[model samples]
Target: MKTKHPYRLGVDLGGTKIETILLDPEGGSLGRERTATPRDPDGPTEYARIRDRVHTLIEAALGKVPHGHACTIGIGIPGTINAQTGRVQNANTTGLIGHPFQQDLETRLGRPIAMENDANCFTLAEARQGAAKGYDLVFGIILGTGCGGGISINGKIHSGRHLIAGEWGHFSVDPEGARCYCGNRGCVETKISGGGVAQSFFERTGQRLTLEEITEGYRQGDPQCRSAFEQFLDDFGRCLGGLISVLDPDAVVLGGGVSNIDELYTLGVEQVRRYAFHERIQTPILKHQLGDSAGVIGAAWIGK
Candidate 1:
């Protein structure tokens, strides 16, 4: 008799959203659920909210699990995660600081769980099952809140010497540029992140507008909005050009809120090609197909 393979659960915990997905070993999403991330300024309040929201989402996903059996769980956290301690180091989620997130979740679910940075997970998912499926080298980028990146070789994450080989967003692109939330000046994130794009628009037009507003303005051919959007595209292309020079990966996949813009891939490819030192090679910039689910879906394969 053959032993049955266990089911798998993938969870993505972000400051703004929490997503959970159940999947089979073949990378198929069985069931998924998402909810707004609760805001709790106080430590205790935040922890309680996290616990409650996680439970609710997981329970909902569990009800949809296709198999009759339970499975192992994996989580992608949006911060500096210490796998050994399961503690979230520095991150936007202040309430989760120093919390043994993996351990606590394991206790609640009655199973061991794997955890890693969400960007890393997303990269793996894209490389293994999404747009970069056939590539040997894949880089995934998250251009929101701050920039986050992940690298995969041969469909596996290369954590590198310190498990940080994929943190490319923190790479400084301009030392004298705007100050970043990470206390660094002119980091690529400060120039190309979702917040950065909005801030740039505000600076140029003196109007506090949503990204959607900016997009609409661009679509309507507003000069100020067009300028901001075009600048963002150009800068984004320059960044990708630099990445291509360094990693020279087969393809790059983009995720996060900003990726919702239709022109990013097209404009980015043009810019990257223009700025890239290697004039003979053609590098493709692929849009993320999995969207928000990529993190959770990729996390499910952690340690597998």
Candidate 2:
């Protein structure tokens, strides 16, 4: 379908901030703005405040476009929309849970909108113009305070029938491991996410260390840090290798805070090869080129 507007507007509603960007047809950014997400003392009013803040941000961005021109809007949320109930689900921002977010936003904005999981938006951004550009199948993973994954095929997100296609974080990797918030035991997120790494370090050394400190200690050859970091790398390999055995995407792009570690592409890839079924694993696992902007950029492309 042809776009009805000269500008594309993308909004990324993150836990701490709301970011909006305007993009022209050639992918040049026309304007961008960000503001703190509103919070309310009352739990019930927080959602409404957030909604109003987002509306204000969108209106501010729209003011940058020519007066007579229209614009298409897309939004990337931390969670997926429940296809059955048409409500937001699995969002870290608890206020949005079970809310008619899309309907409310559309009613307030007075226009049709495209909404997608942020992970899928990241994948779309990478596949379209970032590290995974030109790849037919791309898997994008975010390793921050939490872990999440998304898939893009032929430049389009494959959200699957249940809208959980690339939710690799919840995959049960260990039946005997700690319970996840999702009511599962030994989920992949519990093993390799930033919080998980810190938890493992604390369990091993009885001293709480942030993931950054643990990584630094490992570099200094601290035995305790080494042990935990090694376990992390091995688990990363095992989980990602097992995933490769299933989908075997053309490329894998890593994003979020944890992807900054340079060793993952080297040591982590080797580990993936060791656990993968293939005799030779040649897939290129790359760092995101668009960085933090990928989420909003991908959200913008949803209008395309």
Candidate 3:
């Protein structure tokens, strides 16, 4: 695609890390930067440090742009900025919950920038060129430590009127399920997310274990792990199945850490079909092709 700007820059601001990418007009990578997300020793994060880090990263990437070439910057945030207030909300990273993140960044850089929720970025990238390519209506799922999702129609992000179109994970399912960061009692996220799985497992067995360890233990015939993992799959089915019923996208692509679980495609998918509204469900649930690069790359494409 021909771009109005020769140099395009994008930032992927996630809960665990912050990454930046610079791309040429043809979408070739020109430069990249990544770092651990800032957090204080007491476990709470500082909004100032995060804001400054984003500023510094953008500045560094801007240095590589040719002097005469025009540049555009876009950000893929873990949460969406409220259109009314320009403040971030529903971020997994709690500290960013109420800050006017985009406004602050624009003030810092002395220019306007494009921004969208990270899951929207994920769906846009996939719908344009990745696993969900050619699908008119694509649903992108990010099953990481926390669950998130996005929607893309005809390769363009379908950010809803309120800019919360694909925030699928926050919808409460069980009235008595695990607690979610969004103050919901039983959000889909609190059931199928990696963190949610771990928390559920801890409650069940009174043991602390990572998602990897729990799955490994299940593979090794550990009774407790098997029980928890089976329930997890069922929960995955209930959640995704319900969403599929609602949107009925042409294709659904999965990304993030939890998407790598082999059983999700087989056993987990079977559950999706069983619970789905259609008697002959045909949604092609797929694995991501661009991997972690999708978010940042999509962000670049979004900015004019």
Question: Which portions of model 1 show Cα errors greater than 4 Å?
Answer: 1-4, 52-70, 83-86, 107-111
Candidate 1 lDDT over residue span 1-304, tens digit each: 2227766777888888898878865556777777789887774688778967886676676676554665667778887666566577766788888887767776787766677888999999999888889999998998776789999999888877666787887778888878887788877887888788788777767899876678789999998888887888888888878888988999888998887788886766788888778986577678898887788888887733
Better of 2 and 3 by TM-score: 2
**Per-residue lDDT of model 3, residues 176-228, tens digit only:** 98778788799998898899999999988899998888899999999999999
Off by over 4 Å in 3: 1-5, 41-45
Question: How many residue pairs clash in model 2?
Answer: 0
lDDT of 1 at 232: 80
Q: Between 1 and 3, whose lDDT is larger?
A: 3
Which candidate leads the pack in TM-score? Answer: 2
Order of all candidates by TM-score, from best down to worst? Answer: 2, 3, 1
> What's the number of clashes in each of the models?
0, 0, 0
* Model 1 TM-score (2 dp): 0.87
Model 2, 1-304: lDDT tens digits are 4446468899999999889999976688998888887766447898888888888888788888777776888899899999999899998887888898988988887888888999999999999999999999999999998899999999999999999999999999999987888999999999989998898778767999988888899999999989888888999999999999999999999999989987798898999999988999898999999999999999998863
Judge candidate 2 against the unseen true structure and give its global Cα lDDT, from 0 to 1.
0.90
* Per-model TM-score on C-alpha atoms: 0.87, 0.96, 0.93
Per the 3 Å backbone cut-off, how many clashing residue pairs does candidate 3 have? 0
Q: Which ten residues in a row have the lowest lDDT in candidate 1?
A: 1-10
